[model samples]
Target: MENLTFEQLPQAMRLLHEKLDRLEQRFEEQNTLQDAETIFNVTQAAAFLHLSVATLYVKTSRREVPFNKQGKRLYFYKAELDEWVRKGRKKTMSEIREEAGQHVLSTKRRT
Candidate 1:
């Protein structure tokens, strides 16, 4: 323990820092790849959407959900599922009426 001189300490610390940096870089790269992945199988998709497996299958049968098929296997993308959920949001009647009123105003202005 007492054999380590002052100059040796800095060199050892630098080596440790370089190794730590490489480890951190590898971790970040792995995390990025995981985050970028979007594919999910039927069970994963159902769990993500909080729907029953039967209901998910029904939607697939109706071609109402976004997915990819490889032979008999189906895959869903997390991003597409997110968008599908957003598209299913129902507009309030008041909001629809407001859009209709705007359409009428635009028509009058054109004429």
Candidate 2:
């Protein structure tokens, strides 16, 4: 310790700081990757979508929602679920009424 000069001490400290920074960066990256790879449980998925667990189960049973089954546990992919919701989005009342009216008119004309 006493044999080391001031210049050597600074170099040693700099190297130590750089090593710690690299370690911290790697840890952060690893944590991010782990988070991305994590799959959500049914409750978590329901909460994420703001829906009830029963509704989630119904959707899963109807094959309207995306899920993954591992042994006894069920998991949902956040991205896939989000995309599915986006694709099968709810329609406005006006659109539904218009379609219903069109159907009724067509049926009446056929009769």
Candidate 3:
């Protein structure tokens, strides 16, 4: 390694820091792509979601679950399945109360 002059040390450190940041960003992107691209068959999907195979099939049949169909095959993306579960999340009591308060305030202002 070359001895860095005092004046050049900060510039060198800045450049190294930028390179490390770029490397970290690329690593994160690759990991996200890997997770988002994960595909599961019906059996795997059922296991992943902790549901019975029969129940998974029922949801797919009724189009209640997010899925992909190609010919006679069904496919599920791990990301999509995660999102589906998140979408079904229920509000907490605090959240409902806050919403009710907002509604009451708005209604009072209307009159």
Candidate 4:
């Protein structure tokens, strides 16, 4: 302990502080990236959507939900799911069919 001079202590403290600052910056960057990444596992995706895992699987199978499969694992893109919900918010199959039928009738009258 007595071997080192007083000047060495300040340099050592400065080096330690620099290392700590770098570590803090790295941690913040990783946290930001994690917040940006929307990939979720099946359980996480189900929980996020407030749906059962089985129902999620069924919807995935029906192509109603977008998913990514990497080997045996499945992942959902949160953005795609959000967009899917937005697109489905205001219309049903019957409404769509009725609109198509009206279009057809209007076309026939014009002809």
Top candidate by TM-score: 3
Better of 2 and 3 by TM-score: 3
TM-score of each: 0.62, 0.48, 0.78, 0.50
Order the candidates by lDDT, highest first — what do you get? 3, 1, 2, 4
lDDT of 4 by residue, 29-68 (tens): 9876675477889999999889999999999889889899
Expressed as tens digits, the lDDT of each residue in 49-102 for candidate 1 is 999989999999999999899999999988788889999999999999999999
Least well predicted 10-residue stretch by lDDT in candidate 3:
28-37
lDDT of 3 by residue, 1-111 (tens): 899999999999999999999999999999889989999999999999999999999999999999999999999999999999999999999999999999999999999
By how many angstroms RMSD does model 2 differ from the true structure? 12.5
Which digits, one per residue and each the tens of the lDDT, describe model 2 over residues 1-111? 457787799988898899999999999998877765767999999999899999999988898888998898889977677677799878999999999999999999999
Q: State model 4's lDDT.
A: 0.88
Off by over 4 Å in 4: 1-36, 91-111
Give me candidate 4's TM-score against the actual structure: 0.50
- Output the better candidate (2/4) by TM-score: 4
Note the residue pairs that clash in candidate 4: none
Best by lDDT: 3
lDDT: the better of candidates 2 and 4: 2
Candidate 3, lDDT over the whole model: 0.97
